[model samples]
Target chain A: MNRRTFLKDAIVVITGAALPAAALEWLDPRQVLAENPQIRWAFLVDTHKCAGCGFCVKACKAENDIPYEASVTRTWIERYVVTQSGELLADSPQGGRDGFTSGSIDLPGGTRVSEEEIIRGFFVPKLCNHCASPPCVQVCPVGATYATPQGVVLVDRQWCIGCGYCIMGCPYGARFFHPVHKSVDKCTLCTHRLTRGDASACVEACPFGARQVGNLHDPNDPVTRAVVSERIGVLRDSYGSRPRVYYLGLSKEVH
Target chain B: MKEYVWRPMYVVVLIAALSLAVRFFLLPHDFGVHEGGYKYGYYRLGNIAEWESRPALFRSADDCGDCHRQSESLSASPHAFISCQNCHGPAAGHPEDPPTLAIDTGRDLCLRCHADLSYPAGGRDAVPGIDPLGHHPFRSCVGCHDPHHPRQEVQP
Candidate 1:
């Protein structure tokens, strides 16, 4: 064969082989473009019901298979202590996994206070808000993070480059680099659980029924009913992330 | 000289066009997410399938109720809305190979909600003021009230 024919034949074989292999590795375009999505899920957090038991944090770590490390929390509870002087103090030692002491705000090797100094305090649990207009999804360069049809935000671990852009963009400080997977990790809202008609781990773990996950599209859903009837607040509503997690009895002192 | 120069250029163009044809032929059939104005297909295309490979970590409460029907009494009480797993921990391994779940009988668990706070003394919150010291000092609240139906149980 002549040099030109040989070169031409070689290029064709390589291109033919690579195209299908590349296409198989990504999210299906059809699934992404499906119109008229019927599902819209939301998380309702009743801060009033939260007792700072920290069971939800422990449950989350166990369910998600996250390590028992302080820095890599997928969910954590914040005990907000607003003193009579109107000063706010918040902390979660070990994500409150071992639970919290009410009378004295005992942080891990940090601060301690007597009941005399405190006025009122409450616990606010934190996790991926799964924003409608998620900044994390927007910032992900590889399109690894995406919101599902049911409104759950998920990270495609295989596609993630571990750039941490999504982590930085998350206003709730939910996303973290996975120590084991070495991929960008955050709460999936437990999509695997939700899809099967089960509640998220944290929601199920809440002894007080403080946390709930439901489909906002379904009017009859208890969570949807509660969200509509109750005056709900989102974390940093001004940022316009449109967080799906709704909070009831959220103190003004909480951020 | 002209034949030699032009022939190689023609061959290069042919290969480039053939590569484009292969890519177009192999391109995914469905249009993916809509970007600004146009559609961009095949963006992270196989992720959905990949995600489906993992099993669910949490089981539905209904799964627990299927076998442990006695626990359904919680539905009639004030704690009706509370999930069983909330107190028993994740029942991920229940009914098949049951995992030993922790049962929280501690006062701290009960007091997280029952304990009074100065947050304007009840609007919608079911929280009632308790002195803990005066009402039942050094006593577990579960001693008197059932965790499921607090009002139904009488104080001993």
Candidate 2:
């Protein structure tokens, strides 16, 4: 074959091989519904019922395989003590795993507020809000963090490059670096237990039924009904993250 | 066509072809945005199964009820809301290798929820706390109270 003819034939073959793969990108696979279309998992925290026992925190650590002594946890309880003078004193000793036994809250720089001066005190539990518009998912350079179809935010540890972008992107301070896995980790809503038809460890450990998980899409779900009918609020709604974790009787002092 | 134009076009097609071939070989079979489109976010599809494969270390109270009859008394008691694993530790492998779960009968276990901070606004007052020092010092709570049925005191 002539050199010119050979070159022309090769170009046609290469273009033909490449065109299909390139065009496939635009084909866009047909949108598949989640395994359970009705499932959109959400969390509820009843500040009034939370006794600051911290059973949930310990349970979460055990269930998730987080180090028993790790300074981080998937969930923690924050004690908000509002003084008579309206000074908000907050502290969570060991993330409330050991429970609050002290009468006074020690502040930074050697200051302490005696319990007698406190006009109001309450416990607020915190965890991944699993926002509808998750900043962590958005900021992940490697697409390591993502929201499941059921509305649970998950971190693919295998895919994570140990970058701290998602950790900083999370406004709720939910994400933490796993010392063992060497990756950014956050609450998975206990998907392992959820799929097994059991409540998350934290929810189950709560003797007061203060924490709960329910399907937001199911109108019959008790949590969904409470969220729709009760005076519920989310943490820092001003940020417009659309956090799915709802709080009942949320005090103003709690951000 | 001019030589310059044709030459650049040929190079562009060659690069595209080479890159596509590399991607075809290197890309994971299950890597892509799947259900719910990009709204659910792009991810490695196989990771879902990987997360699911992680076995749960905690089990439901009903799992314990399958074998232990003590779970029945617990269900009827005021402490029914509390899971067995909460005080006894996680029931990952119980009634087998361990044979029995270690029961945390310490005063601290009960005091976790029973300690008096007197924060009435938080609704913890309903739990009925005590001044651990004044109530009954140097003694375990179970000394007088039946943990299974806390309301009914154990006869000495």
Candidate 3:
């Protein structure tokens, strides 16, 4: 074949092969856009009941195979104790998950203090709020993040350029930059497990049932029902992200 | 004859242009952020310097590990997203002669940001004040406030 004819054929073949891979790598727009979402609302962590067990934290790490070196966790729990005299105290001897404080990270003022102990101290787990207006998606120039019909904010890691804008923009400080890939990362709501009609890894792994996740659309789901029956509100109301996650009897005092 | 002469020169210029274009796109800006893993989180310990006029902005948590090797795992915290400066203030000039990097009294320092800023008008009114001197007489904010996680929903 002459140069023109040969070049045209080569271009077609190369682009044809690259197109599917790119889409799959970026985010399978067709597959994602086609599927019906299952999750609607989400669970909340009551800091009062948490015992600083770190079960959810460990479960999340083990379930997702999250590595401490770089693959930052999508969810983690922290320990806090309020003094009898009304002094708010923070302590995490075990990586800020459960009640233990074993692991060490290079953080400022990160050392755990063991002076005063209060029975009132509790563990609190934190994760992505899965906002109705997910800021991560809005700020992403490449359209890497999207919201599901069920209102879960999911990201197409393949398409993500790993920019940290989402990390900074999140009011709750839920997002993190992947150490190695240099891409942005956060809790996925366990879409892999949820798709299989299973509970979230964190929920399933949690021994205390501290985390409860279910379909907000399904009125029968306990989480959704409790939200309506109890009148729970979302976190950081000022953010106006309209988070899908709700808390039952969540205290207004703990902004 | 004219086409032959112009074609080679044109091709040479185009190739050079293409090479230059490659350099611009494949390098730092296109990749977004600096090269390699973010060092701010874990890996080591000690204080990191963030002087206003210094190039030490990107120094990670390892710099601070020198003194706080005990907190090496702090890099693993759930609140690892927070920078050293946000909690303990700046880590200017290593530990300094007299140790300026030490966390002074008051969780209010952190509350200034973490506190609910309801009334920007009455600055302190919106903030949940820490009665350091009156009640607990705590040394630092973390004394009671866990920076890694939000407090549990305190039910009425």
Candidate 4:
């Protein structure tokens, strides 16, 4: 082939290959909205109803494939002991898996106190708040963590680089490194079950009906109604994460 | 154009082309900022499907009520609100290969909620708790109390 013709053909071939790649970038699909736009999931916990049975913790471990013996849990119950002298003691033994059977409250530095000085105590169940403005999502450099339109925050295990930034960013200390998956893991609000019109495993496992999940957009939802009618509060409202989990009868002693 | 200028321009263009090509293949097809816009954050669009595909291990009490007559006995009792799977373990597969599910009859099982820590507030007082040592030391709860009908004694 002539030199001039060969140069022209080479340029054309390169242009042709590069054109498609450039076009594909522009043609990339935009992420779609949630399947049900009207549905926003919210959680409710009745502090008065939680009996500290630890059934929810066990059920969550089983349902989510978290190791039963793992020190971390997707859900856990904390017993708060407020003494007459204004000292606050909080402890969660084995994440309340076996319940609080001890008469003494053990402190972090090995100090222990008998129940005699305690004036009041209560069990508070905690999990991922699935905040509307989740700090975890904000701090995820790789975009592995995100919030669903339904208000549930989820971690994309495959995409997570295991940087642990999201775990540190969380205000409630909700996220944890999975012992097996080696990625930052937390509660998904049982997105698998919720999508199928069933309650989250923890909610269903609560015997006294302490935990509940509901559609915030649906005014008729029992949980929504209770939230509207009851004097409920979220944990650490000052953080402004706009947490979706609401607690009934939340005491001032709780952090 | 000068030869020196042309050579530098060519090198820059080639590197840009190579980088673009690599990114096109490395980026996941389903990764992007979702419906809530940038404030809500970006994630793999397919992760929703991945999460939804996980099998539910725990089932509701209504699922058990469909087969076991003992469920009826529980409804009228104080334990009605509790799911069978709570104490019975996740009902992922049952009454087929295993034929029957194992029941937790340990004293610790019952004492989990009933053991008296004497916490006077925050609804702990609602469920009556007993001093494990003072009440029935080292005895199985089911020996006398019927779990299905917790208020009633087991007939000899």
Candidate 5:
């Protein structure tokens, strides 16, 4: 064959090979997830089982390489104390990294619950809810923060512009601007570990089976079974984020 | 009429072709999914499989049990379902670095499940409760009990 014809044929062959792979980029990720029923992941937090040990918080920090500062935390445990008069006070001291001690919390709501008047109290660990309808994902103008096919919310650090829009948009106060990367950061539900058949860092670190991560689509899965039978609650259900994270024994005092 | 129609049509066609050329020239190649480019480009968010390569810092209970024969005791106890990595921290590099894996059997660690609470009070009876100060005078639970099987006493 002539050199010109040979080159033309080679070009055609390369283009044919590359086109299909390039086309894959345009395929809707949500549609991909919808087709795969096994990808429906969820988080179940039983606050009643949580002992405020702060191990989950510490584990998250170590796993994610997050700063151990009070302001920057991927996950934190909130201690909710109810007074005899029914005054609710919530506080997370140093993101509960040092663990909780018996003490009074100064509430911004201007209600002080002394150690003596404490009627009821519980620890509620908070992290990225990985909402089906994440406001952070919606508000990201650059689409840096996007949910995976498995419904795990992730931040494409390379795509993030340090705009902090996702950080501001998150109502659960999950997203925070990473000091080192200067990009919006939050819990990924340990998508890395989950893909490897290991649980999330927080789930693995909970000595008490307080935190459980499971595929909701699997009928036999413990999380799915619990969700169906148990009266599980999501944080701020009225807001309609449809958060995948389910909570059992969530008190009314918790926000 | 033919002259007027042809001139505008020619200009419109020229503009459209020029715009297409510029768009093709200015647009990025590879969509920057892995290249750290600003735009995902044509909705190319890359493959989910990329996450699979990320290093897993945390190990499962089974992973820990694979090496430690002593972990079998936990399998029979109430904490059977609980992972070994929980109290021992992430044993990413275990036998290679023996001292690196420090097991935290502290009192606070035990209190995390045993602490007394009023809200969500149901079903907590399964896990015992104690006032850290009043009950044991700030003593560690492990000092008197076994962590793997709290119900079973440490046989001397």
Candidate 6:
């Protein structure tokens, strides 16, 4: 079936099971979804192989016309360093790859090298975790932020009240409130692109294939099975958000 | 107490109806941008498949000055490529709301990329220090620094 038909069917199946009886007849989610699935997107990150290259971050801004000079990162690269003595330091690269010649990264996934400091190091690309059980959804007062059955969390700018609660609730600190839109924002994992079986900007931009996208329920799906075969670690699994993105061969201390 | 009527809903009816609302109305659907000029920009997106009909979008930083029209001093800095979102966050929804939906994540977004002291624009050009107000308890680096272009002044 075509995408529209599939969406309509999925909506009927899920919403027919979720909404209140009073609101069903007037606003049947099923009928609508029989047209679309709302926001359906998810990601799986492999930490073991990420080069800490800021390519994803750079690429996101470039593709979207995101400004080049600000501290805002729709996506970013992190440097994680672990010492033999068990000291851990995490930082985003200070100047990204463009400024990498200096080798200074003091933020998440940064390098801590000195004459005496013996350590292991690597990088991870960080973006919105896009959780199935998103806390950002619970804290939104106007219901602007909501999750799709497929588990992508999104905000409706028209309804947003400018509250920053979603920013606080995000376990990965991924949300960014912007001035132009004057709305709380984060990576949407390029939800619009997924309409035609496209991957997110970050996933496509990475030269290393460190980022993967797919559904967990579908066993044959690469991301679903990779999490099992590769021993992926969900960032702060303790937050209980059940983030879909998984990092492989990650240093425990990096979390 | 009587306001709390406990009528049971049919299992199938209850599940189907609720699922529809949650699946469609409550969630945020994708609204893609169709702005021109990004054959290679971060926001200049395209199909993910390697062999897709479209090529990736990218742009030169100076192109932004045409519309933003910042003063020559602010617009010409090396941090010119730093788009508005680099400092303010994604603006896709900004036009719908004014100055509010875009809550401040504080200025740390700036410091995350550029440190407090010294940054370059082009060809080894440099601007030093992110200190906004030396007196405020918040570290100058944390607040005054505008990462979009550290060479520029802090937004009030």
Best by TM-score: 4
Categorize the docking of model 3.
incorrect
Cα displacement (Å) at residue A155, model 2: 0.4
Q: Model 6, range B1-156, lDDT digits (tens) per residue? A: 353343344566788998987867754453222221111111112222221323334222233355566867555655553444433433433445546324344434333333222222111112222333343535544356454455556877
TM match of model 2 to true structure: 0.85
TM-score to true structure, per model: 0.69, 0.85, 0.50, 0.87, 0.74, 0.52
Clashing pairs in 5: A51-B112
Residue-level lDDT of model 4, residues B1-156, one tens digit each, is 889989989999999999989978998977888877776658888888899889988775577767777646566888777788877867777756454565788888888788887658455577778898888799988999988788999998
Q: Report the C-alpha lDDT of model 1 over A30-98, residue by residue, as the tens digit.
A: 576464446788999988777776778877887888887646788888877766787777777777776
Instruction: For candidate 6, give the lDDT of residue A249.
Output: 70
Model 6: per-residue lDDT, tens digit, A90-167?
566432533232233344344345414534556667777877677777777655666544565666666677889988
Give the better candidate number (3 or 5) by TM-score.
5
Scored against the true structure, residue A42 in model 1 reaches a CA lDDT of 92
Error of 6 at A24 (Å): 22
lDDT of each: 0.73, 0.85, 0.53, 0.86, 0.76, 0.56
Model 5: residues >4 Å from true position, as ranges? A1-37, A108-112, B1-44, B47-50, B71-82, B105-156
lDDT of 5 by residue, A68-156 (tens): 77468988988877777977777887787766655556667776656677766777888899898877777778656777657777887
lDDT-based ranking: 4, 2, 5, 1, 6, 3
lDDT of 4 by residue, A1-255 (tens): 999999999999998887866566643233222344578999999999887888889889989988988898988999988888988888998798777776678888888888788887889999999998898898889889999877889999999999999889999988999999989999999999998889999999888889999999878899999999999999999999999999999998888
lDDT of 3 at A31: 68
Badly placed stretches (over 4 Å) of model 4 are A1-37, B1-3, B70-73
The most accurate candidate by lDDT is: 4
What tier of docking accuracy does candidate 1 attain? incorrect
Q: What's the C-alpha lDDT at position B79 in model 2?
A: 84
Pairs in steric clash, model 1: A26-B44, A26-B45, A26-B46, A27-B44, A27-B45, A27-B46, A28-B45
lDDT of 6 at B115: 29
Deviating ranges (above 4 Å) for candidate 3: A1-41, A69-71, A91-95, A101-119, B1-156
